[model samples]
Target chain A: MINAVGREIPDEILRMTGKEPFQGNSYKEGVPFRRYAPIIRPVMDNTHNKMVKDIHEALVKCKAHNGMTVSFHHHFREGDLVVCMVMEEIHKMGLKNITLAATSLGKAHDALVPMIEDGTITSIQASGVRGKIGEAISHGKLKNLAIMRSHGGRVRSLVTGETKVDIAFIGAPTADEYGNLRGVGGKSNCGVLSYSHVDGDCAEYVVAITDTLVPFPNFPAHISMTKVDCVCVVDAIGIPEKIATGAAKPTTDQRKLMMAEYCTQVVVNTPYFKDGFSYQTGVGGASIASTISLTKIMEERGIKMGFGVGGMTKPMCDLLDRGLCRVLLDTQAFDLDAVTNILNPKHHRITAGSYANPFNKGAFVNKLDYVILASLEVDVHFNCNVVVGSDGIITGAQGGHPDTAQGAKCTIVICPLLQGRIPAICSEVTTVTTPGESVDIVVTDYGVAVNPNRPDLLKALEEADCVPLKTIEQLRDEAYAITGVPNPVEFGDRIVGIIEARDGTIMDVVREIKD
Target chain B: MEILKPAVAGTLESSDCMVTVEPGQGKVNLDLDSSVMRQFGPQIKKVIAETLARLDVTDVNIRVVDKGALDCTIKARVEAAVYRSNDIRKDIPWGGAIK
Candidate 1:
């Protein structure tokens, strides 16, 4: 932990921009929990019966005696049931202290809460925790630290040998004995197999679980049979229709669209409008609409982007159809349209670790020329807060915002000037997800604000005659002046939770509000 | 020795480009139609991964024919090809398992 204001800087960064005492709350991505996947022989072989049989055998073999770490993929999103069923059997067997290392822990796995209480499970580590499980863990119910990772960071941890899965449970839309699998059938599917692909490759034992047990060869599969052990068969695997409704949706706010317009103008004026530029946009309405508008701008200018990264949406798909963006590197499907597209055979899909994490050997987000995101609040200094609120409440959660902001060459945060009576421009953010250093600009409905460090971006926007430009401090003062001073939030010393940096360090703690 | 055809024309079949692998004999490469291929890279990869396994077509060349399948769809097709190559039945469930 090199002191921000306390000491010297790292040689690599210091050489480019000399070291100084740091005072700001900044983070560095930490050691990953999972290790990198190298070509390894399958620990067990069960290719003849079917992919299901092979999956089961591998899990049983990997955790031979039980009480070990096991993992699963959330590619099924809200439609998933493999993890719960796998755990039910494990719980039935009375296994204790089992650790679940999932790509991201979803509410579908809420049954594990019982296991956590019964001592069958004691720890959890994943990309993000949502819904009921998030609530339970937040109330200090769990006995262990809930380490959240970016998709890329998770891949890196696994690849770097930080987090090792004794057994990995994989579910497919369809599968064969040779361990071939795909996601295009049943109640809900059309998601990436990237998460499972990584888990299967890294875990010591791999269990293939599915409802659709196809013929001798389950044509097209992501998890290769050679890397699989035994397959487990269940009546059905997904929650039918869940693939459509599993995601958080965008809000139809006029102000948001206006902000999106300004964000698009920022891009049109930036260095990302080239014919073959690559970019990423978050699932927020502003980001999505900005991408939508930007695509039209691209079409108007006859410019085609090289690639796009996302959980994905209809707007993103529309661009791809129009020959605007070249590819969509998908890790998670954030909307129904994305799920539908994923089911089709034309969209470009990628792994979670491969799409957003920095630790991965080659993540797609790192190559992005620009990335658009959202924040609950952005301070005058450009530090952003997405996991906490001004009232000291943990209303927001860190999704992929931080990782993308830090990875992209040009990071643009889009939001409204004011949320209801509360001003979005603040003197200091309640919490910092992406440091001011990583943030290049903030595009609000009224205007655009550039970080002090990015003078070039500031100059470019000025030359373009796009939107009103201002420093973040001026914006904050104007917002406060317009909305009257906000009532100061009271705080107590009792910490509720810790927001983790991608690298596994505690960036900041959410303190209990003193009422 | 097996060439799997797509169900629709200018659909999956028309998506095929070229595979000019350098040192890696097992790798698949193509000078893809960026606007088309990029949007469907994720889906295309999914179809291919599954088809490759089902066809039992290991260490072989895979030429894609894409028509803007999302990331997941791409993976599924290649896997189908893999299964078809091995003459394995393609009538298995590729969906998730219910609780």
Candidate 2:
């Protein structure tokens, strides 16, 4: 069945998952609820004493058995070591058929590929997958269909009981024996423990794994001991350098600079370009370039942004420090500078749920005036494919792309005309990660294309008339003229993964790569 | 335009192709390994062959390790490899080969 966005969701898949097809952005109207249950805590001799000797002890005590779900957070990104360590321990203990529910998975967790093949790790639910693990899942080595959810969607899944996490192994940079956790103040400071907050709250067993154990009452804990069930200390939580870079540099590419220039000009001409306007941008080079360009534009106009939100980066931090943006509602810190700056007074750390959860009453993304993001491929219709590549392999994550695109008054997708030889703009993306209606503008190195749905934006851009603007079809045709039309990818009958939009509807399905 | 010696171009990065072209015995011999082989191996090979044919170079051994590069990228890399192998820098048919 075709969804509202025109993505074909196989009936077999619909029958299997019991998820309705995406019925556009306004599908959900009423309040969503979960069956309430009181916390049935174990009778502990001392409530404050929850330290376990090792992961083995924690798993045994938590009654972690085969065929149960386990979760992890990607705060550490490529530096994370806790997931592999815990999986190794689980394998040693003969635990099998476990579902690995992670906020996101990256190259750091490539070691799990063999485990997935061995049936020790049978299922995966994550925002992103990369490296060998992605190859493993794409090849259909795993026993169950991999479920890809946006960050907001993941929280919604947990809260709505669609997915239940048996144990949440949160890798905290710093923690106490009583299970108080913080992302900073450790040997490997990642800044925000926000992604793990929902898991800590919803999971049946919550364990805080840390390399640095502080004294009692880890003050103003990002995750309190109230929700934590056990604490385990490891040699290291993550590779410090890989977790957060020392600096987040903006792109200096000339073509990308032009795109950024256009993005900035579009914002300045928009109705929401006044003082105290809001902003959000992802961590891509082009997006950051746009943000950096915006700083100059804001300076020239003496306009200060009201707030900046999303994954905190150093450029956004610089804006706050320079008094261009009044506040930063950070979900996850992306660099060393961001991690340190988020500890400051003006930068406020927020949970992932509060950052972009679609089902929530209010989200930081909903109030944004502008959001700049990058895409792997965007069709003429403006439907984006940030999840699957041209080859039909899942390589990217849909972090806050859809949520912010739908919420922000103007969402600009910035990219070059082509990535290598593949056209960034296509007739139809391999997967519809973000629907066209939500997208407002498509900005590329060559020209800009305003979604026809937004005639208001088109009129504003035409009046400003500073940047080169073209129809989306023209851009797509220009790209294809350079790179000949690509052959369609052949996929196998087995559905390897399901791409879920933020509202729990099936946006697209990734099938096994045909041999 | 014929490949004179062994030459290489491109990278193993995602959306890129690592292509090595060498002079062969009057016939095209292609050795390809791709991450997207199941879905695009044949297409990658076709792009390579068509690119070489456009350059009018059939006596070449093309070794490609494609990381899901687009056809245009594959064509560009093939042209670069052929030019580099032949040590031809001036008056090269760049646009024609790419087309």
Best by lDDT: 2
Worst 10 residues of 1 chain B by lDDT: B15-24
Error of 1 at A165 (Å): 1.1
Could you give the DockQ of candidate 1? 0.01
| CA deviation > 4 Å runs, candidate 2 | A35-38, A42-48, B1-23, B32-99
For each candidate in turn, the TM-score is: 0.72, 0.92
Q: In order, what DockQ does each candidate have?
A: 0.01, 0.36
Q: Which stretches of candidate 1 lie over 4 Å from their true place?
A: A1-61, A64-67, A246-252, A342-346, A389-397, A420-423, A478-498, A504-506, A509-515, B1-99
Q: Write the per-residue lDDT of candidate 2 for residues B1-99, one digit (tens) a residue.
A: 777799999999988999998889889999999876754567788888888888888798889998868777888988899999989889987795676
- Residue A20, candidate 2: C-alpha displacement in angstroms: 0.6
Lowest lDDT 10-residue stretch of candidate 2 chain A? A34-43
The count of residue-pair clashes in candidate 1 stands at 118
Give the TM-score comparing model 2 with the true structure, all chains together.
Answer: 0.92
Candidate 2 local Cα displacement, residue A80, angstroms: 0.5
The TM-score of candidate 2's chain A against the true chain A comes to 0.98
